[model samples]
Target: MRAAAATTFTVPAELSAAEPPEVRGVPRDGVRLLVARGHGPLRHTTFRNLPSALRRGDLVVVNTSDTEPAAVDGHRPDAPAADAPPVTLHVSGPAPDELFVVELRTPDGRRVLDGRAGESIRLPGGVVATLMAGHPDPRVSTGSRLWRARIAVAGGLRAWLAEVGRPIRYSYLRGDWPLDAYRTVFATPGPEFASAEMPSAARPFTPEVLAGLRRRGVGVAELVLHTGVSSLEAGEVPLPERYRVPTATADLVNATRAAGGRVVAVGTTVTRALETVADPGGLVRPGAGWTHLVLGPDRPARVVDGLVTGWHEPTASHLLLLEAVAGTALVGRAYAAAVDRGYLWHEFGDSCLLLPIRTVHRAE
Candidate 1:
């Protein structure tokens, strides 16, 4: 089957939901999933079967970036003298050194603002958010415009979040979902103030499933990437969220490659982590830093050889990263199969495991 080109896939608004899935804590590896080869047809499966899908010595890279309850609502300090209407501040992104950038949505429009460095944005009921920095992301209008910003947080951000911030629920499932629904089963450490929801590599991996994969010879590695809240706004412009790949994670990837193992990224985040640090010939080195690198068809991958991820919306920028690995033909084929099979879309939907075109051919 031929895959569709990057230009051929577009995000459709109808597919996104205003609510999240009704299911919660359904064993990370118990989620429904699909597997496809190149642009070929899809095969239905459970997430627990993921390890069986790969060969021994294939390195599976997972993003351990935890989801953050970064959404906050408040009134603008620069509010007009007239009646001060409340504004919604989504602490969508973070800057270097734990500073925060926030999206301020008000009657005027959505604007990106920075909280006073080390100062907090006081919300209704004593909830205070420390301002980090103010670097505005590109904007899109939806009756009111939407702006993405980063923010720094402290003083029980996670505990207080249970009381104030709502799980940055996608427009799906029609109602609010519990926080556990937005996280992976193996989630450790408190949530970061960056990701709106989990990066989800751990989505399909239960403790048992991970053990099985290890038994089968698949080596797994983890990395932390504090992703910003997902801006699923229709027609939203794509922007890079600042992230860091720790030296330890880099070492594992390098060791795997040195041993001639296939490095399989668990999600786009892992792909970003590997690609961000990789040089030519797919050589990986230890490093920590921010990456604005965007991948697509024209750009070849230096580190990642495969990606395991959920179906993306038509407007999602993730389509570009998919193209970089499997090419337009393979991704298009897999996506079409996903649609025809009635596989769910978005974070709660089924997933696909994509291998490089070369690997598929070699297997053939």
Candidate 2:
């Protein structure tokens, strides 16, 4: 099958969801859900109906990675003595030698910061981040715009971040939101903060939704994939991120498959973690490590039979993964239907389910 990695689409700015449905006076689970089956008619439903949409034997795997406050406001120590533009630092992930893979954005979140190597930037709460080098990935094409820097904080990194950092937000958002808004309902409370951004597919789920799934005999499993900064720019490839699939979850997935159940991933993060440790026979194994896996038309899914995710941006690289799960033709139809129905797009928006169908034809 031909991969659609290079394919592009247009998303109108008006269709972007500037605020969460809850902020608009709707419940968390009141968002829309677009159900797209391979070669089947597209179905429009609500997120609360998820429990009734799947079979009893289906296993839903979710990412339990907690969101970290990765964004912080900073200023260059050596700028013009008059007026220096403030910078926004987005901590992508950890790098070798206590360094961090960071993206330098302007205060408006429109362009990257113009800084040179060896420059010192003063951040909030007395933290100083120094640019150690340019693009860390040698495999990246020449003139890449990413930055690699090291930070010096008085206390521990996590503790200091908790005090000064805010959740990384894009320009589309209406205003600043608290860190709690970026976390999923199933997020585990612990010292370890994993994702640089939210694993948003499960954001629409609430306690009521989980209870419904449990009562319907649908199994839910958990995995952790600390995601890095999202590559929202057009044609940008995502960087590697840490992931872990525990033995319990792997066993559940394998057992469910053996019992003629579908393995449904709640988000792209879960799908990436499971596929990384999946054997040729499609059996998942317990594993933990960093993965640079990128799913597209060229990469066919072997472990995940279905995917529950949110509507992605037109230029988002994640669209390639959706195309891999559902064919190109089907994905096209699904997006058309979503836009036609005025479904919201983004982390706090609606959801979509791509499942298998008996027929292999495009929806009309």
Candidate 3:
């Protein structure tokens, strides 16, 4: 399949890429959340008000896959002993078998680190990653200086990251906040194996919001999509990361359909997981596996009828997944509304909740 290409909406470098809303302080569940119908315009609301937006019997599928400090400072194994450029190994995904996909870069040139597959690089706190085979060029733009590759991590992965790695904060954040802020309240205790940034949807639905959903008859299910480091370097094409949808979540997805309820993916990560497991009938089946599926206009969505997600920049590949659900026209409308009305962008910004066309009626 043709890789989903980048859009014009990616925030330009000149635009201030700060994360927090201007003049606002942090609140765990208080970020803005917008709701849009498949064929309608965007509506604004805070995340705490999510239960009011959905009906009973709607199922919310969340990605429980936590974030990892995939970005590490390292030196090139092949570089000359003294003058080797200080390199950053931005981890991406595991290829078929145990091999990994990693991005390697230096002041001189950028390339994938493959020749030393299985060689261990000790991190700041004794954590090590066994270098693995490299995969395709996941670059979205030409002339990018950063490269994509993968690696096999060793030791208590989560613990190791906490000790040595900085939270792989996106460039827009200006400075890094505590990694804890990036993660969801429900994140599994272990170190994240894949995603570079925390999938933000799980952020808003705290225990209280979740209980409210449950009381209102909403069913919650968890899926895993270990995300890799985002290829957000200037002029770089977005890269694909490793992802997995566990069997139990798949079953809940199917069950939600059988019960005639909406299957609502909580974030792009969950959307990617469910889309990976879809069959010819557009139904999701039970499975625990990896995926490199890139959803966009060309890729028809099968499992999710609606989605709740953050307001990503135009360049973010996540928008392609949203296009799959809302269609290009609807996405354009929602985005226009988001920008015109001053909706915050990025993980710490506002969110958008999209409903399927059939459910959102427009009176003439």
Candidate 4:
């Protein structure tokens, strides 16, 4: 599937956030927020002021799929360490036939497109990942950005990750951080449940921010979308992802929209999950399954009225989702203003609140 036209602006190097806001002597909620209300001009503020952006009856849905330490270093055991350079494997998730969708990257974060099937990567704690085939299509063996691999580890992959793996990060990010730094306040506690990368929109939402939202009478809803690797090559559509929208969340969304209040999704993940379970009339139902939904100008959001999201790469599919919730004009304007004002980019960067004048109007 081809992507509809969305924002395709360039982000400057200085605007890319390289580390957590805490490392920069700023609280997570202190990151800048760009407000793009359809009827009004763009306004800039801090993330801590998010609650005031919406009305009292508004419902904010958040993704609880926590970030996992999925990046692990491995090398082929058959070759000498000198001959076989260690490859960093970013595990997406378990695939069919007990295989896992994995991307092998060099230490410098460059995609290793040369991964071949039958290659065994020896990892710490007796974990060995064997590449089975190229992902999406097993027939295409070479030049695949992602590979279908099987991991044989003690206990399980989740448990093994806790001990040795780090969060998957791109080269724009500087240095390594503990797994804790990659998690959001809404991330479910414990080890078994996690997303390959952080559900970054909620990263700046601290406990204090939650308290503020509650105090303002805004409802917080929950969902889970175990996201895969977000660094897909430009023009590559996102693969199917597992998501769950609970009965309570669906009920709240319907109630809020029915009463003329907005349902604000915390991120593109939330938007996708909610839209997947929503009916043509904008009513949502509880459901859990893999979603291949691609929101864009052609398939705009059906239930969500507003969005609280992070900056996305110009070519990234998430931008298409943004264009679905907010109109293309508003999204393009917001991104232009963000770039002009030097707002940060990436998971660790700033946030944007997109409130389109009208969100849902089913085709006649």
lDDT of each: 0.64, 0.81, 0.65, 0.88
Instruction: List, residue by residue over 310-341, the lDDT tens digit for candidate 4.
Output: 99987788888888888889999999999999
Best by TM-score: 4
Q: Write the per-residue lDDT of candidate 2 for residues 3-110, one digit (tens) a residue.
A: 335435567788788887889887889999998887658889899999888889888999988888999998866557246568888887788787887788878886
What is the TM-score of each predicted model, taking all chains together? Answer: 0.77, 0.92, 0.78, 0.96
Each prediction's number of clashing residue pairs: 22, 1, 17, 0
Candidate 4: Cα lDDT at 167: 92
**Top lDDT prediction, candidate number:** 4
**Candidate 4 clash figure, as a count:** 0
All predictions: root-mean-square deviation over Cα? 5.8, 4.0, 5.4, 2.0
How would you encode candidate 1's per-residue C-alpha lDDT over 1-364 as one tens digit per residue? 1222363544445544233333544555666677766544567788889888888878887876666765566664545525445666666655545444455554233444433343334575665554433344323222222332333235555566657776554434566566676777555564445475678655656689888888999987776666765554544434565566667777777777676667888888878878878886676766565667767655667778788998887766777778787777777878877766666667766678887545321210
The list of candidate 3 runs beyond 4 A from truth reads: 1-23, 39-41, 75-84, 96-99, 105-134, 137-159, 190-194, 232-244, 359-364
Model 3 per-residue lDDT at 335: 74
Task: Give one digit per residue, the lDDT tens place, for model 3 in 190-268.
Answer: 4336566687777766787887787888888887777665555433434555556667777777777777788888888
Error of 1 at 134 (Å): 6.7
For model 3 the local lDDT of residue 266 reads: 87
Ranking of predictions according to lDDT? 4, 2, 3, 1
Per-residue error for 145 in candidate 1, Å, reads 5.8
Score candidate 4 by lDDT: 0.88
